[model samples]
Target chain A: MANVIPPRSGTAFTLARGQRLTVIDPCGEQVADLVAFRADDIDEVISSGRTIDYASRIFLTTGDPLYSNRSNVLLEIVEDTVGRHDFLLTPCSADTFRIIYGDKEPHRGCFGNLAHALKPYGIPPDRIPVAFNVFMNVEVDGSSGAIAVRPPLSRAGDRIVFEAKLDLIIGLTACSALQSNNHAFKPIHYEISS
Target chain B: MANVIPPRSGTAFTLARGQRLTVIDPCGEQVADLVAFRADDIDEVISSGRTIDYASRIFLTTGDPLYSNRSNVLLEIVEDTVGRHDFLLTPCSADTFRIIYGDKEPHRGCFGNLAHALKPYGIPPDRIPVAFNVFMNVEVDGSSGAIAVRPPLSRAGDRIVFEAKLDLIIGLTACSALQSNNHAFKPIHYEISS
Candidate 1:
């Protein structure tokens, strides 16, 4: 099945083990926050820390394995059109908006969108996990240990693919924040297959 | 209800929001790896990174809020007897045993025990999250940034209490690893109350 996740919106679906899920940026420069859990036990989830530790690298590319906290493989990158993706940053939230944009208004960021999408599956708004930022460009300054978000390098129609190692409940959210007038976020396309 | 989790064994239970779960070191030298997830969604789970970032500290104590990856409050430390817990280390696993102990023999560490306990709840063995090591004395050397395991400071009947912020499925495992000849592991007691 294929679906389009609108800008600032979210969607959820189940991917059986051995199945594949692909996220596409129809228009370049968009970021998608993705979260996944074991279908049988929601508590066992994808761990960014474990993934980084297991891969021995911070950025993920084709052939990298995403691991859970228990050191179990969750997903494997089977295909990638864009070579850069971030596994070091946490998903943006309302609290992040308050800090970065100085906006006191309720801005449901990727965290809120994910919670809203997974609510019917029994996930509460506050229980959303940190995510894998697909198509996002983040770089670390080695000497100072500072991280900076840069404009994505992916072109329109670029996509990344992952093969599930277990039955997984996956959530995807199109980011809502904008870096500047030159950069604007767009919707993401999803495709899942057995 | 109260239950005694034997040394080298594990247990699982569900706690509704607003309820409390207390972990007690019955014999004073035990370490319990505690992992929690949102009862409904399972995918939104405890994240050591988020908890540390949110609390702004690596060591946990009373009044500290444990946050999930989405920055949601999972549990609050309402009571503590020893006042020290670790949120920086991942649960010990078979692979870790190979690295630390150089033993090729099959060893069931906290990860295996937690997976075994949570199996009945549909959680597989690999989904265990990084745990909060309760009653475990792990000290880090500031100069070298090296962590060393030591005997627990808790006395018999010493415990820590967490008030759940959401419905949670918690798994607790009595550590099977031994520090040395003088340091031995013991059973852990669990108590849940509204």
Candidate 2:
């Protein structure tokens, strides 16, 4: 008889082909923070260039390679149906809450989650940098140069694989509740294993 | 008679209604460390859900009130484009640089700029919280329940205005670049005046 598996929530990790990590939306909807970093001296890591080269395309699916400031490979996409991803935009701050979310000051985005996760690694919030908008699509109008935010073109049960070039500390967040946007906000499943 | 004024690279202003403070391109835009506190007492402030209500949104404009972690209105959005913004994703940090840029960290885009600006004010980078995604459209997707990172529908030269709720310390940077994951990567202009 075949073995039975229970329902899985959140990410399922499976590392291979260099170093692969996948973050599942579990619920088959929504895009969350799945950031990566190159490790240096355990708790030390760095970002790539401040800007993402994808113009407005957000989302990280198959074949995506996250570059670092050092020009070394950080994270590479091995498998992903969640096409473009968002790696831009820093986590929220007080002013952000005030400007965008009037009267709301505290909300946890990718940056907050990363800060918390790295706490065990002796990293604090002050150390969090701008994240790559993985598996998210942010497009710019080539003609007018306008920015357009859209939903993930990927579907449910999709996965993005990345091979880590060097030792790295990847921060994953199953994006919290984003009820003010559009269809892109859905429960997404993730997995990462070695 | 012709009234000749000094030449300015970008627009200069005290920040009025319908005026945008800046445009953030995940590809190259970056805002640094910022400190928000009760304008009354700049000496002491709070952190993590003290001054700001994480559940609510705080609407701001030029010279409007901006509360701190201690729930004291601190700074204000001297300029903005998107009327309502998000306070969740703030500026860059050390960890942020590591995650996005990786081991080969870019010299810029870190919270260093924020800290540098705060140094003169006797504040530290730790005091700054996440920032607002001004001009950037981050709507909650109903079907996916995720905050979609979309480009702002606003046209070039469009504006979002806010008032300083309180006297606050803010550090900003026009992201030099984002090679991580493409979103909105462009030169952002910031202006401040009394």
Candidate 3:
């Protein structure tokens, strides 16, 4: 789609039913680690549950459909490589690492490494929820609705891919280097297979 | 919570009965035109099939508890306007006005100004769906799960207010310079009253 670009040492595909997977990032600076499950019972995804409220932009190109929390249907992109991705926002937390490294260091972030990577599969770090900080840049102020979190149109090795119709356990946050308002601290690399 | 802040010419506070409103935007470019309806039938807004899904930032900020989609308890955020707000991701069709200006002109987006500002009531515009780009900054490539789309961390005025708990008819796109990849053309200004 973007000149058949798909080879950076990390690629894979599959999304049969109702097919459609697209993800493009060209050189927007990679930061993908999506997780899915349920295609044939990988461990139930589509689990935003409670009818799902909102938040999904930390990057996930195309029509953006990988809902769960019990909503089901874990894949639907079709194709893309830089068309634009940033699914809501994530990649920095713990009160944004104590407001950008304050609260006297020793602060564990990225949701404390996603609770030590799901604490060897017992899950519980307050349930690991707030994630998805895709391309960075956040704005919201229509007459005092303030929200100016920017710094990331993407730069450096950018990438985006999708095609997992269902069956996902995707969980990635390879965005270390505690940054604020957007990039200054770098280190983002990702890869996934079918 | 951040010391009362909501006056961009929008008011209607009565979230009393159990106050708990919290709508911040840190820096995501404000866009909060909320509603809940039912403070004794102020036209009803308890269920638009359950709203507030700013994609997935989770709703009712002040401790959280908006629930709907059939979960119930429509309001909570008692008081908020200390930051970001802007959730209305889709509403610019007709090929996005010929792909953001040049398929001619006059596309009017945001579902034609929210169906001409609610067409004096009767509402229509296919019920309008697909919105919730609050704090925009999409990126989905945790190893090929593509979903790029970018731009927007707020730039202009900057606000965030939400205190109704119920009584809604919200609809605002206000800005649609369009170009896909998550709005980056220009034109933003939205407001809502009690």
Candidate 4:
């Protein structure tokens, strides 16, 4: 059975090694922020720096391994429908809305949602590193080192699948930022299988 | 007198609000990894995501402000000689050497150095985020989104200066990674002025 993450919310659960977790954009054009920590030691969390340094490319796709801070492989991309994703931006938070969007009433955003969901497993707030933003379209101007966020290109039913390489604690969220979701909020679906 | 950090090491210190910090590359082709946090609260630390989002560019230099996670300005670059720097890469760690370089005996890199230097301030290892790499040169291919490390463009005596907007606890290093420093590590010099 596939689990559902409501719009602008998140959930945390455990994944055994070798299990496959497939994240689906059921309504399309929505972003999902995913983060993983080793079950035995939360300190060894997924690291965007290590993964990008190894891949030598900002746009990661199938066959790329997500690496941990300790340089161990945590998960590998086995299947992907929409090839674009973002590893640069940290999860959006109240500060993002206040600073970037000038929102008067700021939403707690993905960082807050992930922190709340992962709290049960003893993952503290500060340990929340940059998330793997699935289906996000972040364009980088390599020459000027500039960045711009664009609406995701995912159509209805687009999905990406990852195979866990270690026993992991995972936090997954339906991103709350309006700009990332083509101005609409939608639930995310996920299936865990051996 | 300028405070000196020996090659391949780091130091932590406090800077009062409104004071100025000048980080000097006394030797050519050396990288300095710098991180700062609010003296009152470590949770309000320097954020690469926020800085990049607000600056709209990756290459921060004179006139750009370094923002904290809370959307507050922590430091502003008041002077810069070598314009290029990196905020995308986390400080190199033991895992960096072991995994990327395949070194049998790894040196504790900038990450370890910063952790050690900042430990006394009650800042745990997990609190270390991506740092502002001063004087280091990194190239990004705009079309492919690929990254390449180049030797520091800084020559002897090149300096970047920052003025504190908030009372700050700073962790800074003469980067240990050979590639970042053109295959040689050299001491970093800094002076704090009112």
Best by DockQ: 4
Could you tell me the fnat of model 1?
Answer: 0.05
Clash number for candidate 2: 171
TM-score of each: 0.60, 0.47, 0.26, 0.94
Cα lDDT for residue A1, model 4? 64
Best by TM-score: 4
Residue pairs clashing, model 4: none
lDDT of each residue in A90-187, candidate 3, tens digit only:
33444444444555664454445655655555444433432344444444332332334445566655554555655444445444433432443344
Instruction: Give lDDT tens digits, candidate 1, residues B10-125.
Output: 88899999999999888887888889988887766787756653443557888988877556889999999997666545666776566567778947777788888888788766
TM-score of 3: 0.26
Provide the TM-score of chain B versus the true chain B for each model in turn.
0.94, 0.58, 0.27, 0.98
Scanning candidate 3 chain B in windows of ten residues, the lowest lDDT window is B3-12
Off by over 4 Å in 4: none
CAPRI classification of candidate 4? medium
- Displacement of residue B163 (Cα, Å) in model 2 is 13
- In candidate 1, stretches whose alpha carbon ends up further than 4 angstroms from where it belongs are A180-183, B1-89, B98-103, B106-194
Better of 3 and 4 by lDDT: 4
Question: Which scores greater on DockQ, model 2 or model 4?
Answer: 4
Better of 1 and 3 by TM-score: 1
